[model samples]
Target: MKTKVQAGGVSQSPVIDIQDLSLVFKTADGPVNALHEISLTVQRGDFVSFIGPSGCGKTTLLRVIADLEQPTGGRIQVNGMSPHEARLARAYGYVFQAAALYPWRTIERNVALPLEIAGIGRDEQRRRVDQFLELVELQDFKKKFPWQLSGGMQQRASIARALCVRPELLLMDEPFGALDEIVRDHLNEQLLKLWLKTNKTIVFVTHSIPEAVFLSKRIVVMSPRPGRVIDIIDTNFPTQRTLDIRETPEFIEIAHRVREGLRSGHD
Candidate 1:
């Protein structure tokens, strides 16, 4: 779909647009506020990270974008359409905290499952599965089951599955949070490369400062329960940056700002 530029050629319509969005959960105790007056816009092909403490509604925000959860107040649009509409159109893909791959399915089968569900022909499914497995560097493991692959590799397969659909937007919720630091670092690098190659508009939820700083063009910080955006820090880092970029002074400075934003949110 083509992006629509507004009157006077000011700015293109955002890939994801949310304004004054709020969500509340009904509980035994009464009502719990999950998000409050959250407003944000994500442009096409932008890699944006949402970082916050537990219960800060970062994932809730992502869920809103994915239409997995309904908002109680305000408005949101994905790809210039309602989240529900966008969901119906399969405009986005989601990668959850866990790999969530089925043990019964081989890596290739797992990646091909979505295509099969979408009624794509067998030949197209094979083509997409092979292409995405190679994209994630897991072509060699296509025949293996989820139980046979390493945790990191399993997550890579999950990512490949998400990409096989070729959604314009990707919503990732701490996909690497469960892995060891070393593995997480490596996956982060691979994910960065994947994002660069695919140019997907990614909204990633993470608690790791360095990961957010390293991967995002913009880092959005949120408050505790009744979450509100406390800051939206722009990194503007080059797309081709390496893991070593984390050691740079500019990166350090941005990390410090993110830390401060988190601390301020708590206060």
Candidate 2:
């Protein structure tokens, strides 16, 4: 939907807009605050990374945007609609920490399952499955089961599945976190290329400073436990940068700031 701008112009509302958002979980031990007054706006095609300690609400916040978890306070709009509506509209695709692919299904079938559920025709499903698998460079692996692929390849297949839905936004929760350092770096590069190609608004959760700096256009540093945003650092590196960019002084400086922000959050 289009939105009216104040300057005699029309514009789209941010792909994701969140204001004073907070969530609490009720447990036997009492209430646990997961997020605190979180306010953020993600523009179209931006890649934003959230980084923090283990207990922070990174995944929780992502789930909130996905409408898998409800917020207790404040407001959030995904694709200019309530998260529930946005979810029903299939406004975004989520890649969780694991591949989460079914062992019984071939890679192509796993990627095509959602389309099948959505009632897409068989020919269309094959087209989308082939298209996305090629996008993720897994076209040849389509016949193999999840158990047959390497960890990194499995994650790539999961990403292809997410992209097959053709959502405008992508919510990724450490999709490469479990891979080896070399594999993680390679996937990070591939993911960057995919983001550039798709122009999808991506909100990624990561624990690595270098990964955050390397892949993000903006990095959101968060506090521990109660999960408040401590900083939002911008990166102006070329969109086509390679891992070598991480060795540059500018990248190092950004990494330092992210590190300091995490430290301040702990205090």
Q: Could you tell me how far off, in angstroms, the CA of residue 251 lies in candidate 1 after the best superposition?
A: 0.7
Alpha-carbon deviation at 62 in model 2, angstroms: 0.3
Model 2, C-alpha of 143: deviation from truth (Å): 0.6
Candidate 1 per-residue lDDT over residues 67-168, each given as its tens digit? 999999999989888999988888888999999999999999999988888899999999989999999999999999999999999999999998899998
Evaluate residue 124 in candidate 1 and report its C-alpha lDDT on the 0 to 100 scale.
90
Q: What TM-score fits each model?
A: 0.95, 0.96
Q: What is candidate 1's local distance difference test score?
A: 0.91
- lDDT, candidates in the order shown: 0.91, 0.92
Candidate 2 has what TM-score? 0.96
**225, model 2: CA deviation in Å?**
3.0
What C-alpha lDDT, on a 0 to 100 scale, does residue 7 get in candidate 2?
36
